[model samples]
Target: MKEKLLTKEDLAEDHKKAVRGNTKTTREDWLAEAQRVLIEEGVDRVKVDRLANKLNVTRGGFYWFFKNRQDLLDILLANWKDSKNDPLTHTLKGKNKTPLDPLVRFIFTTIRERSYSPALDSAMRDWARTSNKTRRAVDLVDNRRISVLAKVYQGLGYEEEEAFIRARIQYFHQVGYYAMGVHESHEQRLHYLPIYFKQLTGFDLPKEALQGFMEE
Candidate 1:
């Protein structure tokens, strides 16, 4: 016996073993892990090595998905601005039979379903403090969200200035609620939903809306 060569089947079996030892992680998986670290440990700790360890994968996998840590950070910001904010914009843009229908749906999305993440929002805001690029992105998101909200109020028959003011008030109130770390149980928030609705939108929480929240 002078030498031995592996056949295709042998190579395939070796590939399977390699896969078992270190599963291939997708680009989305890396982004999600980076975001989790960004939210939990802050931007400083969202390093490639740190994320690799947390994801239980090699650092090389991250480079396969992202050019560098900065590229991943930029994509994370984009995803948050576009995807994370979709529910809010979608709720407002919906063509409900009544203006209040959109308002009701908006309340449900933000409060009941929690399609937005307060922790992620806070983390981004914290990151903004140190990065001008992040600060601009955050400002753009805030303005866009408020602008859409003002349009919703305008559809409800408010004047331009009043609609803008009301939008700011509602947006500021929710942001501050999270910023201040106000602890309220689900039931407590539900209890105050009607009051908040009235104060924010100048419309009574429809009995049906309240019923829907309770049922949900």
Candidate 2:
């Protein structure tokens, strides 16, 4: 029998299969898996071999992207800090074209969309209990969040003292809800959102904005 050569189409199809079988994992993939482990199993469980096994890939995949385990952990911490602060800063820096704009944006973005991670937040707080470095990171995130929230209230015509207090009330309420594992569905919480906003700011959030949250 004569030797046979593959056609271009056959070669291309083989290449596709090879690529599909060995999917390229990025730094985000490793970080995401590590974060999941950190949240579920705590920081001690975020080791490279452990994560690699969980991700169903060899440790080489992790080493290729990270200098070492500490480097990967540092990146994860940085991501947590950004995830905590950025969205709050963005949402609170509102033009407030309407009386309810800032409050509505803050509620919608922070509460409903929940752009940050509660599990990660709780995990980080637990980690902070032992590590001063982690504690400082948590402090920075908390201070920035509360300060920005205070500024939002100040913008809503609250005095500096009242603004800070109201900010604490709102922020602490949220932290307590997460800490206590209180679960309220959107439907259950819907009627109370505007009421909470009003009590927090001493001003009614517009009916339209209230409706927006209810509809969700």
Candidate 3:
């Protein structure tokens, strides 16, 4: 008896089915899964073998999609930024059910909404000591977020420099709160929202309506 070999056409068909199932995946699928894995398990577990285990595939399977682990991590970093602002991100160039308001409530809502992206960002930052690419991507995401908040400050009638300063302070506060152990009902973060925002921007976010404070 002779060993049989698969034709290119047969392999392609198998890959097509794999792509649809997210079991065996394409490069983009690997990127998305890498990002998701990092957010859930951190970088140490984002290795090819582990991802294969997590996805119930084989280690050889990842090489089919990514050049290497570093390449996968890089993709995760890039995707993290896109995930941050795509839904209920604090930054706004367009409309959202909730735009910027009391810094505290808005920050909590964002945490609740975009939980994975921020967790991935934190995981990447912690691992940056070992990876240059991760460090640079983290720096870029932080700066872009600052820029977005600065724009929001300007809309609220602050001078550019003042807006920039307020945005900086607000960012720092939110980072702390995100990592803190503050439990609240849906009403809790919202109820205390004014206190935190007043402390940061010298204005409390009105709970009922945002005051459209920036509306002319």
Provide the overall lDDT of each model, using Cα atoms, as 2-decimal numbers: 0.81, 0.75, 0.62
1 versus 2: better TM-score goes to: 1
Give model 2's TM-score versus the native structure: 0.83
* Candidate 1 residue spans exceeding 4 A from truth: 1-22, 83-85
In order of listing, the candidates' clash counts read 0, 0, 0
lDDT of 1 by residue, 73-104 (tens): 99999988883456777787877878888888
Ranking by TM-score: 1, 2, 3
Cα shift from native, residue 172, model 3 (Å) = 0.8
Q: At residue 100, give the lDDT of candidate 2.
A: 54
lDDT of 2 by residue, 33-57 (tens): 9888888999888887787677666
Model 3: weakest 10-residue lDDT segment is: 207-216
Model 3 lDDT per residue over 1-216, tens place: 222344556545544545335354667666767777776777777777566566655455465565678777666666665635443244344454543443434455464554324465567777776778778776777677777777777877899999999888887676665557356675576556567677877765665543332231
Off by over 4 Å in 3: 1-29, 82-90, 96-111, 114-116, 181-185, 210-216
Q: Give the clashing pairs for model 1.
A: none
Using TM-score as the measure, the top candidate is: 1
Taking all chains together, each candidate's TM-score versus the true structure is 0.87, 0.83, 0.71
Predicted structure 3: lDDT: 0.62
